[model samples]
Target: MKSTFLILSSKRYNYYFRRFSFDFQNKVIKTKNLFLFLTLLVLSVSVNAQQNQVQQDSTKTEKLDEVLVKAVRVDADSPITHSNVSKEQLAKRNLGQDIPILLNYLPSVVTTSDAGAGIGYTGIRVRGTDATRVNVTINGIPYNDPESQGTFWVNLGDFASSTESLQLQRGVGTSTNGSGAFGASLNLLTDAFSENASAEISNSFGSYNTRKHTIKLSTGLLNNHFEISGRFSKIDSDGYIDRAFTDLKSYFLQGIYKDENTLIKALTFGNYERTYQAWFGLTAEELQENRRQNPYTYENETDNYWQDHYQLHWNERLNSNWSTNLGLNYTKGKGYFEQYKPEESAADFANLIEEDSDVIVRRWLDNNFYVINANVVYKKNTLEVISGISYNTYSGDHFGEVIWGSDLAPNTNIRDRYYEGDATKNDFSVFSKATFKLLEKVTGFVDIQGRFVEYKTNGVNSDLVDFVTDANFNFFNPKVGFTYKPSSSNNYYLSYARANREPNRDDFKAGVTENETLNDIELGWRFYKNKVSVNTNLYYMFYQNQLVLTGELDDVGSPIRATSGKSYRLGLEIDANIQFSKVFNTSTNVALSSNKNQDFNATINGEVVDLGNTNISFSPNLVIGNSLNFNPLENLQVSFLSKYVGEQYMGNIDNEASKLERYFLNDLNINYEIKPNGIFKSIVLSGLVNNIFNKEYVSNGYFGSFDYDDTSSPTGTTTGYYSGYYPQATTNFLVGATLKF
Candidate 1:
């Protein structure tokens, strides 16, 4: 009966294949071939390795209590380049900054902030890939908005406080849930259960009138079965830029039940944030005149947003060889950025005015996301397998409203919305992966995933343009690799992966764009002995239809991007850590890459001109970061951090005028702990001095072009270029204190 069912399913799929277009049919065939090849390889290896006795020690397996992130996380032995940040490391930098700022020192990472500081809206790029291309997850749940494909750290202010650990995998990582990992993937696991009750209070004050206060309490492991923990935080910052202040509040709560073979957890977390608008950076002239000037002079210009998340997770260890995990998650998000416009057209305002007049308007976004994820794992002897599936739905509404206007009409209401649109999306995917020990020192790995995505939009945009769009996409991603361990202290790995990503809402609005594809190959070597460790990796990624910056800004100040014909990124990454003594250590990481647009062309004077392999925008050729730690006393520690970024272009055109200069920055950090005999169990004090050299630099910028005519000159036509920059703050300091009992 099973054979008959399989035959029927194959026939049905064949019929569907015949009905599809030629290109789609080819894609389906390619996916099938990839699956078949992987299956054959796995089977061949298993047949030869099954004769050897397998190691079935339960101590070698991961515990079920930590299964929340197992669905999307990769093991250390996996053939990937990754970095891990623990809670203790985060606490040292969690004074009053966002998560992106905290992760700025990782390998192949770059971060920027709009408020001249890290307290407000911030952005992160990995391997020159923008936030939109980076896949993010929290407890195995997708964190990026389905439409924008971007993670807004501002909506989760001080989230680092609740994160127990996080992993950053660079370059087409293992298949995971939600959007594909084109450049990188980040997964965060919240605080785990504690065995002892605890209470804590934290406070910090810094430059620009920045301050943060937090309170936390935990009822750890009640009756050895249940536990509850919660935290509340409030942060305020007067940014370095004029009128760029921030006001934010956030909270987190968790309840857990645990036993020998079962674990269930419930979590609720959210944040409310408001900040003055500072989206527009400074032009060259403006930067030289007044570096802190803000274009928006209106006192009430601000962006207000709040987000809430609820998640439930269950993990059951059916037996020593089998374990399963299930997760249900929902997120509610709403926000609006308000602005005051001068000389606005009556037609543009939905005919609210008969002539041009000043008006106050708001662009709002309200969205809800629901997701279900499940994974089952089987481990026996030298073979392990995992099968995972996930489904997600997102509904979002975008609208524009006239809050205040200089009109005389009495019937006009402030609450009336002029433009509104709704967008809905559904994403579903299934994946299977396996690992087997082929030899005493060699392990093989394979992963395959199939995903289906659909997006629909209805209504008009703020520009009154019809955005009735519907798109459907199917993707198959496959990864295979092997790890060879020459000894306990040395290992080498080689891997190749394929990844595909669908266009986001913003990309759709720009124009019709094809899906993006990447073929990445990686080779790495690691060596560890005594107090010294070193890791180096070489990667080459070939891309098709990759989206790149065009040096243009849309109506709402968002950067406009266009798809390129072909591109490639080749790089080498090295990271090392050395312990000089029992109390002194140093860690350094460096990345050097060559990124280019292959056979690039542009239309000039109605003629297609070959640019010939120009540099890709925003991808610096070299990035270096280093840190030194010292323990002068038993309870006091001091550290120094430094970073350097090479010059990079702001647009794919790669004109000399559109380049950002190289920059070097340094920071100093110090922390001290005290254990008193009084009521307080421990007290910690910390301080951070940023930009210790007071160096002035621009971390991000854009370029624009304009056509000009000069009748008096020899040439009657001229193309002019302009550049803008987002400047960083000078030397600043932050002081913090924490009390625990």
Candidate 2:
């Protein structure tokens, strides 16, 4: 067996070449198409043979049909479809990395990390939608919080260690839970129950004191029925930004029962994280000073937090052609970050009062989230369907205290408020979805989901005192989609989906409670061949009442109330994977997108002007990725990856308060493996070099309202106005080794 890897590292090598020799002229050069075909054919044959051999080696009670169990959105091998990243691939490169980083090489995916490294604050935008818009599932269960609609990957520290397989669905076709697949959906499955009890340990280190250590153990299959598996991991990093030190840890445990026609799984996991406030952006002058600011600065007063999750799943095949699955999921998360602010008559800093303590000026929150979700699925040839419901609940509280800080004062001056007051609330809702077949090789699916959301705050500053009463909402969301398979190797699809989101607790605390919604219409084409695959999609979106983050807020970070009259995104996405030959492989992802806030009208920084055509905040105009893999020797593999991001705004008002400059990033890696028979399958050594050129770049920032004058052509405010950019790491090098069992 041969391990596959392509290295595209760049170096200065001057090789003198004379006029073409007769031997060179006689040498054959293959076309790109031929190379792609051969590579696909070989890969398919190799993988197919491996599966057959593995299956043949295992003995079963009956000669049952070979069934492929998929841990993904759709469970079929439909062309123009899904790509599964295996555990081996995940571990060999960028271990302890976030899920988004694991999918960087796949089609139509653009992943960015706030830490300038893959281990923390990583995000993936399939096509053009942000992380919040993507539906994520772990072991076939939804993972995003239904209320806040945000996926905090940090909650699962070192989860990659426990994962055995993952799939990224680029377009909507299959039936699943909760929200429809607007941009893409990710599915991950942890390692299976082991046959024998054994424990293993692994550790790795990369840029920014980023390191991970994990241990895994599983009881071998017991009594032809039950088995258990568990894992623990700890990850710490002095984040790319100064002061942002991350100390995170998590654990996973599972009990499983499997047989010829039945499989039941019970699983639970949780994580605790404490990091200096890195969410806060920086100003221009700061960016110029080394571009990398420490997170534990004295002026930055932040809090710490931790969260946990639990789930149960059961699957059975009632008959040969009728298999069924049912799942129940629950999650609980609580944590907070603190800040310093001035005292006021509104009793704002009430929650921070420490018992038996003097008054001090400061603010922070103690937030918590809970969710209960269930789903069922049944599949058949030529027709596949799924239906399920979810009940989600969320609650959190905000408190203030007279800590050692003056309100609106520079240098974190000391101040203590006279009184204490706080606020809190809860929200709940339910939803359902299903899909069916239409015609030959064509399938259509429709989903209808609804949620009843409500929240409240107690104490002197509770109940959204400034806004209307009872800030509650009930919404109905519907989506329709179609997938056409023109041929066994070709597929096309079209889909439309819309979503409505209620304001989070913070949105209301600042006296701004508005419904922010998004609607998307999409169309795309897919192609698959023996060795190469491609997917391209076009999208148009509509934003109604989007919560535009106001640079200036009333004592809180919530955006001021201002409904976007009209805003849309139009773009094209193209992703392709090709292997030029047995020793070379390449892939590229490119997004050409344009987002504009049409007719944006509001009293932005006290000015009423038509702020239309302004670039959507945080939406980069262009994102691109390219990679090349090459193997110069049988034991050595080298690769290079390049990423580019076009300039973008930190605010919708197009002001100087916040904006990020265009930047490009590059990465390189090299690995060599030695296959030793019997005792060890392979001995591998690897190294990764990040920010090859040490280019300075900012991941994201917040805008300041004071600097902008209504579409006054907001210049890139490098100082004071913009909170701060997550300064990317400078060029760094790492090396590690692996021994297979």
Candidate 3:
């Protein structure tokens, strides 16, 4: 069955590629092999599964009858809250940027691109909480690693290709099944199975030689009872910063079987990213001398990563009042960045640089991670609830090779092979939530969760060492909220939630150099129609043995940190959306916040420093975002948006000298939907001008450890401090076409 499937898939791809000139590109050639494999799998599944059960169950389909986002007990929604950017909306807002950068127009949101233009290594902050605090999930499976709980957007380049819609839930939200939601929860729904047989070819190009090409295949009306769909895309770009480049590829596939009361689904996808290590940020002086110089920079280092995910789900209904959601997911990740180190001859450095070795050492990140989660949902006349549990484990080897060290004919030859520490981690969690309506206008909800985690590492050495964190434990956290709807268009809600978060790897590893904390808060809101909304949230986030990144900068330019007496965050956020008519729309958001260390005394470079009443590092006083849309003609529309950030300090001295200056930035987008949704229909468009004014502003960055000529030296020289920016990209443009058949 599989062999026959492969042959059929090959023939189809050959036919498809024959039409594209890029089919001959070097990268495209190598990539075609992988797609060939995917095509075979899809073909095999399509040919062998003669029944619709593999495509979808007739009963599980969205009837196109009821509104789901509104009926659900999710907090991301308010009568005034915004959710779901239509396919058209996403196309019109095309900034040729990463998901985070593209969504920067949202209220109280800020995005940073380590790769400069959203093409690689980008992140989004919601209401002050960074990506580390956000809960990201794709099709209900948690996207965050169980151990570090971090989401690397770069790993899934152009993932938006398969995504149909996404919702960002700010702050505490509806009871979710995975990691705690501290900052926000992003739930993504990938493209649903198409009902017909059609294919689309899309291509777009912009600044930095950045471009993306995509091919999608739909088993058009395949037997009318079954559908198979898949997407293959490749994206590459020359980063704004010197030496920065991105080469990435990704895939998405799904098989669905539907019936009036049952639904079964099989989904698989993955991505690979090859990039340069631009983490070593430049200094103001360095930025001037050579804005593109990479100090940690070396030769042949490719930050390459690949991930593959698989899931199976079955939805069954036993009766009118009871149903169950059964699912299983598995993810595997592999790849690493290779780096070169200069040779050294000291006795202690002897191991780092072997005798007669080459001029550089290569390092690799053999990281493989996976997770499994299962959920069961039950519903009654006025109550609904779901309980679930999950288990995850992963292992990674940070190994290296002595390609050369000290022996080469060069200024500083270093190359040798060595085993760096290899680490393995495991994690699990159990959670549940219930929602009940006691009266026609009243509803209540509660969720409880607990988790267990452990880890260990081997292969220790002189400067680098091994560590262990093997343990099993549980933390019980609960939340409660109420919603009242006097009419279909308006609703009032009050929610009180208490959540706890264990320090992930970034916190512990960057410890003594960074900060971490926990939060507790209450929220209130009112929604007036989907176009207008109001909210007031009072949160007193408390920290236990807080690790606050001080506003102080080390000689090396990394955020310095210390154990604080206590740290607290009190803040408020407000957002609104208004539609003057079908042709005009406006949205805005504001955040007022204050974060500080209550008390503490610390020593830096052997000097006693007072941290009492000092502001925490990277904490901003205010953030604002505004967007406006106008329709100048029936076939054209334009949008303008601006993001304003307040001054932010980098250290804890309450120092005014080292603060990042506030800046206002804007972007523009315009699109014309030609022949939209018609026979031989299509859309042709162009997007322009991101960071329209080209305002130069620095976002948050860090200072590294000070290097002393001698441990006893009074003045230690600071190596170049590394930093990142919410760099406003130079004005850019993109032109693309989408066709439907």
Candidate 4:
């Protein structure tokens, strides 16, 4: 068996190697320093557990840490549609890709990458809703940008390594911090403090000149009450697209103190990233000519950004029935994306110069965010109640500077501000939720929240126009649900929830956007027996004044949205896991949905046309994912994964040119572990082959329409459609090894 496995692996490698070209020298040189850094860091932190005092049971600390997120998480029996992912599951494919890409196989999920290889600038959409509407929290603290309401995974490269577990709650699952969840709410729990001293070094190399190096260490529990753990990671990738490259460095450190019923943690994590711009995708002609071509040719066309996050958490268990948690966070972010404009009008750049000339400019965002959260949980025999209050304040400065130009006005100098603006926002919310057993076979759930928000901005925007806004909103959200379990193997649930969200900064700039509201209803069933488990969920979501995507991108590559008077999404999602035998198992999920904008109206050919009952932009009708796993040996595992996305339109007008074709993809993954008796305890090796069939596909794009008038035509005017597409890589592979001591 061993010989056969070896032969198969060799043949597969030979086949792929023959079809691809590798710059071995360049890759080796680029990763040499990373290897050295990992070795030094691991050696310095390596320590023997026998030298330190024995600690309390690690399970106690783990339980206390779990308490930190209890207020925002739901259990399997709850009336919610959610999925939980563990570190073990994530580790199987944690090779250089972003978290969204790693989570691509989940239910109702769609992920895209601008760099084509999932190493930089990734985005995720759930149930036809974009990232801006998806609420994200790290250890129960809001992680989305307060102004844009978007989550930038590039700023936290390789964060999956530090995550112990995560949960994705679809369709306004529960009350959480930050913006309301119109699509989904995701919460991540950081790694728990280890009870024994340990250290690990990991390295991976893949296609497209991609490589990752990570070093992790834990001091274990010192004197039975304290521990220190940290991780440092570096990732580099030359993407499939021309001149698309990413260089990222990140660090995570935490100091923990814990006892039988108390836990205190202080942590800091941050990343510095520099990546060549690739957001401008290909046009139709360009896609057919050379899909990998990039239009931007400037040498320094890049984005440089750094963000640091600080958090402190305290959890105390007063008694069996009462517990409390307090969390504080301070985040500082500063970054800028540089661009070179040719033959640009000087008046468009704050009148910095008198005439149209080629220029180089840098747009910067410097921001500070502060958050305070307090929550308490009470539990008895048949009832559990959680109440929490969160307050956050954000202040950000937006400015642009002209670095160089062919021509300049008198008194104008280098590094002068072209346009400047500032914005501040304050958000406060209080929520109370309870779950209680009402009868022998029934459980009831209720949640209520009150949120208040104030946003203010003043100054000139990049277009040299006065962009000032002062908006305030008050919202009340409520949720009710119930679960019925007639037998241990069967469970049924029904729920209804309401959510309201204020417009983001871009919304205000686009036009007078109103607050959006959602009413969601969910029905679900769970069946588990023996080695098989299945979950089915049906959901209906109705929106009022919803900000739907217009399939257009701003100058900075951000998606543009417009208010839809009324919209609805109805879907059925089913996910299952079945163990057919001791060595073989399978997991599958499918989502079938119908998303539409009622009585949609648009300006076509210089006329307001009522395009009644049109499909919502970027909302696909079918999505399916499946995984087949086989454990040939006790320490070896191999899996095959598949994904299919149905065709979807990119515009509300439903024009043929705005449609994205459906595509299917397959991947192969292998993992093996070896135990040794020497200095290292274990060595693990992993390999992944993505898009195994080498299928060409585009996962995301944009669409727009322009009207032109012609005297020879009867109507005298015509509408033209233009679109851009982001093509994904055909086939790629990543292989990695990890050493634990």
Q: Residue-wise lDDT of candidate 1 within 93-149, one digit each (tens)?
A: 789999998998898999999998888889999999888888999999999989989
In order, candidate lDDTs are 0.85, 0.59, 0.61, 0.89
Pairs of residues clashing in candidate 1 = none
Which wins on TM-score, candidate 3 or candidate 4? 4
Q: Name the better of 2 and 3 by TM-score.
A: 3
Model 4, clash count?
A: 0
TM-score for each predicted model, relative to the true structure: 0.93, 0.77, 0.81, 0.91
Candidate ranking (lDDT, best to worst)? 4, 1, 3, 2
List ranges where model 1 is wrong by over 4 Å: 1-52, 55-59, 408-411, 604-607, 708-717
* Regions of model 4 farther than 4 Å from truth: 1-62, 713-715
- Compare candidates 2 and 4 on TM-score and give the better one: 4
Better of 3 and 4 by lDDT: 4
Which predicted model would earn the best TM-score?
1
Q: How much does candidate 4 score in TM-score?
A: 0.91
Error of 2 at 539 (Å): 1.6
